[model samples]
Structure formats: structure tokens, C-alpha cells
Target: MKSFDIVTLTVNPSVDKSTHFSGLIAEQKIRCKDPLFDAGGGGINVSKAIERLGGSSLAVFTSGGPVGEMLKELVTKEKIDYEVIETETGTRENFIAVDDNTNSQYRFGFDGDVLTDSEVEKLLETISNLKPKFLVASGSLNEGLSSDFYQKVAEIAKTSNSKLIVDTSGQALKKVLETGAYLIKPNVGELAKLVGVERLEIDEVNEAAKKIIADGRAEIVVVSLGPQGAVLVTKNEYEFVPAPNVAKKSTVGAGDSMVGGMVWALSQNRSLKEVIRWGVACGSAATMNEGTQLFKFEDANRLFEWLKNK
Candidate 1:
């Protein structure tokens, strides 16, 4: 059997620093108050959310330098188990700015340094050993890595008898779908790109999602529609799960939170529809918080109750 419940893989993790400003101005002194920093990157966000929901998962990735050190400190504080491959380049940092008045947020992201072949190989070797029940790989691939990076990880998960859940966009997601991933969670925009067309209505979006399911590329496909809710497409069924109406806070890490919730529900042997219910609850919960604060068990439980009534 499975040694661990979940294992998260992030190729490019970062230290996310968020601050707030009253307004925005170009070429002007825009000083904000104190900033908040947290361990980031999609997979890390997922692992953190899982921990908050009273579940534990391992976080595996590569890091180095001062920022990486900060990441390790926060991970230690969270009591997360992680296996990091040391690299020459430091971990990257992402900045987010929120305007208290308009409630609009602006984000700036830096490109993490490229990873050497040996560094990538080290991560693969680690995956070979753990063989957790669920392999959750999220976030963007760093520079100098081919689209086949996720595909290669999927192959590793397959050989290890682990279910692979991918949360990525563009070619990285497309390539993995072609390789038949166990599950894929993509937002509306990512779904449109995968369908090879743009400008889709609900029906069109449903059709596009079915194409991937029909191809047998992925057994489960989750398409998240911002306010319209989400759709889950499986081999034999396609269902739409409505979202709870909520207001306020930032939307960062919502997708990752959804993936985390889905994996947790699956570990509990919940049905696919129940998994989607928890996924929506977690996604909605994450949006109710500011900065990198993801979905906690309390919020997730509250949202689950709201989902039952709705």
C-alpha cells in the first residue's frame, strides 16, 4: 500500500510577498505599509491548504539562497514535510498589491532561475522512492524545461502506482493530458486553450471538455468558471457543481486549494461528485481570505454546509 496520503511536486516554487497600497501610480513614489511573506508556488499552496484542513502531505521541489531559506523557515513553522533539491539559483519572489478602495489587485511575478539537468534528475529520484498515494503537481514549469517535464513526472507516478493530479496551464497541461493524467484542474481560460479555440459559451465549454474526456487523455477533468461555478467531466458522466455566492478578499491560490480539497476527499474514498463539492468549497474558502492565507478547515466546513443548503 501507500505510505503517504499525498505528495505535492512544484518545479518552480517561490516566496510570495504581498502588500497593500491606497492607489497606483506609474513613476511615482507608491509606498505601502508592511508586507506579508509566505511560502508560495501552486503545489506548496496545495500542501498548506491540506495541512489546514487537518490533512498532511509532502512538498517536493528545488530551492536555494536567502529566499529559499525563508521558504524553509515558513515550511518548518507550518510543520510541513518537504524534500528539496538544492540548486545554485535562489527561489523567486512574487509581489501582489491590493487597493483598499477599489478592491482591485495587481501582481508582479519574477521568473525563477533555470534548473540544471542534474537538479531535475534529483527530484525524479526522490519521487521514485516515496511513491505516495496521490502525486499533486501544480505551478508553472521554470525556464529551460520542456513541456515534457510534467509528462515525465506523470510517467513516474504511473510506474509507482500513484494517481497523478495536474494543475497547470498552456502547453504543460496540454502535453500531460495527451499522456493521460489521472486528474486535471484548469480554469476557464486554460480549458479554452486546451480546446484549441477561443470564445466559448457554457455549451461550447462543455463540448470542449468532453473532447478531452472522450480522447481518454484524462479520466477526470475539472474546469473552474470564476463566478459561474465549475464543471466536472469524467469518463461516464459530466456534471456541473454550483458555487456558493461569497464576497471579499483575494483569489490567489483558489485553484490550488480546489486541487488540495479534491485530493483530500479522494483519500477519504468520497464519490466524484462529493469530491467536486469539497473542491468548490475549498476554492470559495480561499477567495474569502487575503494574501496567501488559503482555505482552513473551519472555512471549508462552513462552505460545505453552505453548499448543502445551496
Candidate 2:
């Protein structure tokens, strides 16, 4: 298995279409630029981000209908390896349109079609067989799929001795925590909820993360502070890396880029210090790109260097 085969599972994948328009007028027609299509979802974006850093990962996701086929084509175009679980219903499509006059983005998303029991079983089977060194389960679970599905994936990870890195929100994340994970990336707001608090101050971030680790919910907790950068906390070690200021074009995929960077670093056996820095560097670098695109290796490397000194 090459010592560390990284596998990413993205069950509710989407074909993301991004474009720009001048303005939004209720009564008038709006003209938009030609749309750019990209395959999207949590784990898939993570795979794409890893590829940008010159690493490889298997993006295992569910696909159906023409939209699903197009999504696969896009992933192939990126030169990332993948395993698909074909479904009866079509994959969902997400729309992101930017208003040029305001420079604000409006995102509209649709729920993915439900998967049959057999398809769901195939997903679990594929994950079990891969037995990668690191398994990442990101994005939202489908409508009919229970949150306990992640609970099952967590169990599979445990049985396979795979380090599971999760980057999901809401009940799905909660379920993974219950089963325990090697790592999880939750934004500060999500962290607050996990600890049963309304919010957390900057200094309190470490304590909040430590609480989860202390409970064995996760071995390592990475809190995304957005533009403030991110922090990595374990039972005994803590590292905080501040984000370097940059010209950000879009915020899409920044969090996934962070997860991808950290997972790739983990596969390389990089230290936690290096891991967090690489994560912050990749995430911040992702914002410097246009819509639906991730970071370039050079930008991420430069940012990592800057973060290393800090």
C-alpha cells in the first residue's frame, strides 16, 4: 500500500458551477459570464488540494446520471485517481455566482439524490477494502444516509488501523466524535457547539479543543480560525500558526485545502508543527486563487516558509 495510501470518501458529491454577473435586479434579466465547472465536495476538494501540493490520493465518491459523469470527467482532468460508487439518482449541482459590482458571492446548493441500500453498502465496502494509512471523510452525508454512517466508517478505520481525519459539520461530525477519530478540523464556531458553549475567545480555543481530546473524541483537534489562521491541539502539545495576510479572491475550498495539507504532511511523517504550518499555508494560499480553483505549490511553499519563522 506504499506505506501511506491516502483515501478520501466523498459521498454526496456535486458538480459546482461558478460565474460572475454585474448586478442583481429583481425585475431585470442578469447576464453572467460563461460558467466554469469543477467537481466539488469535501473529500474531493481535499484530494484536489493534495494533488496541487504534488501528492496523490484516491477520491472515492458516489456518482450518477450525466452530472455525475461530468463530475468524474472533471476529476480525471485534474489527474487525480478515483473510485466511484454508481447510483440510480443523479448527483447534485451547486451554483456559485459572484456579483462583480459588489464583489459578493451568492451560493445556491441542492441536496443530493438519495442512495439505495446497495449503493451505500458498496461505499462502505470500498472504504473497508482500501485500508489506506489515512482516511478522510468530509462533506455532508446524503439526505437518507444516517449520521451513524460515519460511525460505521470510524469503526472501519479502527479495524484497519487507519488514521481517520474528518472535516464535516453538524450531526455527522458529532457522530464521528462519538466513535473517535485521529483528527478533526472544526471551525471555532463548531468547536464552541461541541463544548456546549455559545462561543470561545482566542485564548479559550486551546481549552475547547483539549476538552475533545481529553474525552478521546479525537486525538488531535485542528481549529480553523479563518483569517486569524489555525491552531492544532492535542492532550499534551499545542501549536498555533497565524495566517499571513494575502490577496484573497475567494473563500471556497480554503478549509478543505487546510485538511489536505495536514493529511499530506501526516503521510510524509512531518511534525505537528510542520503539519499545522503546511495546513495554514495551503488554506491561505487557496484563497488567492479565483473561484473553484485551489492553491499553487509555489504559493503554498512560500506561505509555509513565512509561517515557519513565525
Candidate 3:
């Protein structure tokens, strides 16, 4: 087994198929453009994003049946090192379509195949043994899996002294907070939910994140504010970096790209300010591409430079 500075876990990986159509009409056969296939899931996208930034990480995910095989091939094509835990059922596939006329993207996601008890154990064992500097558990839980899955990963990271960065929502996110992670990236809405609120205004973002940090739920809390940029909150600090304006294309995988950039910067021992900038830069640049293509290295670099001066 090869060693890695960072390791990403994707229990519910997917084969993402995307296409474009002129318009969406009810019960009508819509002619669409050629389909594009990409491997997608939270951790998988993060690993892909890390690679774009000239960094390497071990991608650990579950694989089963034909769709799983195709997912492996796609990850391999990206030149990412990975480890797979085989299961009994095939992986799920997601569909994304864009209406060229309205420029609206519609995404249809499917439930992942359930994992047997043994398969779950194997995944935990693999994670325990890797013991990387950082452990990132992202994406949703599959059917038949407990919502406490990420909480278990958090416990493993705690015992191994690995800094855990989690990007998930709902019960999984809430559960993981109990074990406490090093960092967590929740958008304003998700943050609001975590803190038990209907919504959070930009002004209240800092206080909300500080409450999490105060409770030791996370050492650093990053709340993504979309076009307004993002806010980084620690026990004693609060920093907000504005998003640079860019020609928009698609938003797929943008959040994962942000996590990837921030994690890679942390691995390199960059300052918190620089880490947040890298995150925003990567995320903003990802909007320049169609479908799940993520960001271009040149674009991210340019955005990062512009952010530094602003």
C-alpha cells in the first residue's frame, strides 16, 4: 500500500452522464447533444481537483458490478491512485442535462447500492490502516447504510491523529460533528440547518460558525456563500474572501473542488488565508467548464492571484 498525505473516501461513487438539449417539454422526446461521461462523487471529485492542482491523494471508494468497473476505469484514466472495497451490487449512475435555451441544468441522482455488513467493515479496516495525514470523508450514504457511517470515520481519524475534513450534509454531517473533525465545509443553508435555523444571513455567518468552533465540533468552519465568496471561522479569527467574477458555465463539482484546493494547501502548510483563497479560486474556476469537468489549473491560478490582491 502506498502512503499518501491525503486520503479521500467516497462510499457512494457514481458514473455521471451529461448532455444538452434545446428545451424541456413535458412528455416530449427532446433531441440532445452527445453525452459526456465522468466519474463523480464527493471524494472522487475532490481527488480529481487535487490532481488538477499538482497534488496527489489516495482515493478509497466502493466498487461493484459493471458500473463500478467503469468507475474504476474512469478514475484510472485520471491517473489517480486508488483503493476499492468490492460490494455485492452495482454502483449507481447519475444524469445531468442542460436546457440550452433556458441555460438551466437539471440533475437526476440515483440511490447507491446497499453494502453488506462485511463490506462496510472492510472499508473501515482499509481506512484505519492507511493512517494518512488527512482523512476526507465526503458524499452521501448508500442505501442500507447507517447515517452514523461518517461518525465512525471521524472516530478512526481521531484515534489515528489524522486531521479529518468532512463535506456532507443532513444526519451524516450532524453525526460527524459529534466526534469532531478538523474542518468542515457547509454552505450557508447547510450551516443554518446544523445550527437549527431556517436560514442564515451573511452577517450572522461568522457567529454561527464560531458557535460550532466554540463547542469543539470543528477547529475550522468554512461556510460557502456562493457568489459572495466564503467565510472561514476559527476560534479566534474570521476571514471572508470575495469571489471573483468569471464567465459561468456549470456548477457541478465546484464545492468538491474547493475542498480539494483547501486540503492540498493545508498539506503544504500554507496559511489559513491562503488556504481559503485557494479554495475560492478553485471553486470559481470550476464554473468555467461544462458538466463535471472541474477547474483548469491556469484558471485557478489566475483567480488565486486576483484574490490575493483583493
Pick the TM-score winner.
3
lDDT digits (tens) for residues 183-206 of candidate 1: 898877788888777866777777
The residue-by-residue lDDT of candidate 3 on 107-205, one tens digit each, is: 999999789999999999999999999999989899889999999999999999999999999989999999999999999999999899999999999
Overall local distance difference test of candidate 2 = 0.93
State the C-alpha lDDT per candidate: 0.86, 0.93, 0.95
Query: In candidate 2, what are the lDDT values of residues 1-310, reduced to their tens digit?
Result: 3333899999999999999999899999999999999999999999999999889999999999999999999999999999999999999999989999998988898888889999999999999989999999999889988888988999999999999999998888998899999999999999999999999999999999999998999999999998798999999999989999999888888999999999999988999999999999999999998788878999999999999978
Q: Tell me the lDDT of candidate 1.
A: 0.86
lDDT of candidate 1 at residue 295, scale 0 to 100: 69
Give lDDT: candidate 2, residue 172. 85
- Which scores greater on lDDT, model 1 or model 3? 3
| Model 2 TM | 0.97
Q: Which prediction has the highest lDDT against the true structure?
A: 3
**TM of each candidate vs. truth:** 0.95, 0.97, 0.98
